[model samples]
Target: MSRVAVLMGGRSLERQVSLKSGARAEDALERLGHEVLPIDAGPDLVERLSTLAPDVAFIALHGRDGEDGTVQELLDVLGIPYTGSRVSACISCADKVLAKHVLRDRGIPTPDWHAFSETAFRELGAAQALPAIEERLAFPLVVKPAGQGSALGIKFARTAADVPMALVSAFSYDRKVLLERYVPGRDLAVSVLEDADGEPRALPIVEAVPNEEDFYDFEARYEIGRTRFVCPAELDDELTGRASELAVAAYRALGCEGFARIDLMLHADGGELDVLEANVVPGLTETSLLPQAAEAAGISFDALIARVLELALNRA
Candidate 1:
């Protein structure tokens, strides 16, 4: 057993979710006979890590500094091995616009999007900008912050009148906002992990069904029973194989390390799949998709935690 620090509850919009994830992880690690220290990440994160030096850090934090590579950079300087991707990979996957570019460059299929800064939106005026966006992407577009997770600051605009409010809401969370053509389809998530052989492999595909919400928003994601996850998704062999392949490709393209959860949209016609986003540090709460995928693959929660810790130690 090794000393493991589970870092969570950072100063981010997903702080509450992070706390839940960290608590679950801490319990799993302890059950696996490891010395677990739960730390609520904050401005004094560096100091806290120094005070409780552990063999490895289980990063359960999400959004902002936790997911944007800020905390990873500090951990690197402190010479502490942590779970999930490295600094560069985390940085690339943290921003939606950047991740889309990487996926497209890698020949991965991702939805076409337009990104603009809040200042540009304000200076250009909605009348001047709205027409161009409508012409390019059409109606039923998804407006969201380029650098947030858990579907925070996300809005779906079905018409021109909804664009202004959507932009305002999204820009409130981030300076850069992305507008993408919303594709109607099934929501699927693929969790990829580096096996004992150090090879990145895709786990079972999880289909997320929102009970009442139109989209899998923050509520559907964290609220228990709000979303139903069908593991190995109800897709046929061909589609499942294709999704799994795309997921692994996306993971490698982003240079992801330990693990990641890739979200995709399976079109209604079941002919096309568009990569939505790559989550470097996916949520580990009871309602999270990654853990559900692992459980479906016959890996218990305790074993999964131990495996993630093993991956971190091996990389170190």
Candidate 2:
């Protein structure tokens, strides 16, 4: 039992989801007999943390300032150890484009993709090069804001004509946008937790199967019953091991500490698995995937939260 500040509800686009995550974490902390101080991250975040002087900060915030290294750095400056990844990992994982680049550099399997900034499209005439990129990546691409999470600004471009509108919508959320080749297959999530040896181990893979034949968008993700999550993903032993190994590799490549969630796509055609991105501060809500994966791995929700808190205290 320690003084733990659960940070949530930031000004980011994922504010609502973050609030739910933070509330859940706070409940867990209370159940575990820890004094919890829930803080809605905003302009007075540093001020509140300084005033409260909590021993640790359990970050339930997602996207933007929450996952982009902003809040983590502030906590570091205040000398409060926090749960989840460090500042560098947060920076790398928060930006979809940067995380993919890191994955590629580490010889990890990630989908082929391209990124563009709003400035590039408007001032530098990057739009004219769309046809070339489209030809290279092919049709039915996924367009998303480079830094937003909870699939906030994701769009599917089924054809060349759809690309412009998708980019516009994505750019509305973030200055940078990523266009990736669509892998028509199973959407899988691998949650990685450190073992006793401090080695990252992959939890049971959770496959998100949408009820309708459509993209697993934000609505389908957060809203319960919109998508069915199959624990262990119904994969064969060899494929499961391969997926687990890849998940660990991605976690280590990003320098993530404590825990993280790696999202991957398994191709329906050849079963080629490729990582999409890493979520440094994965959700902890009732319908979140990380908890379900943990549960499938035989870890209860309370135990999972306790383990995460213990890991954060290890920095001391």
If scored against the real structure, what TM-score would every candidate get? 0.94, 0.96
Best by TM-score: 2
lDDT of 1 at 127: 49
lDDT of candidate model 2 versus the reference: 0.89
Query: What would the per-residue lDDT of candidate 2 be over residues 121-229, giving only the tens digit for each residue?
Result: 8899999999999999998888999985777779888899998888988888889999998888888999998865567899999998888765735456556677888
True-vs-predicted CA distance for residue 143, candidate 1, Å: 0.6
Mark the 10 consecutive residues where model 1 has the least summed lDDT: 213-222
* lDDT, model 1, position 142: 88
lDDT, each prediction:
0.88, 0.89
Task: Report backbone clashes per prediction.
Answer: 0, 0
Model 1, position 53, has a per-residue lDDT of 86
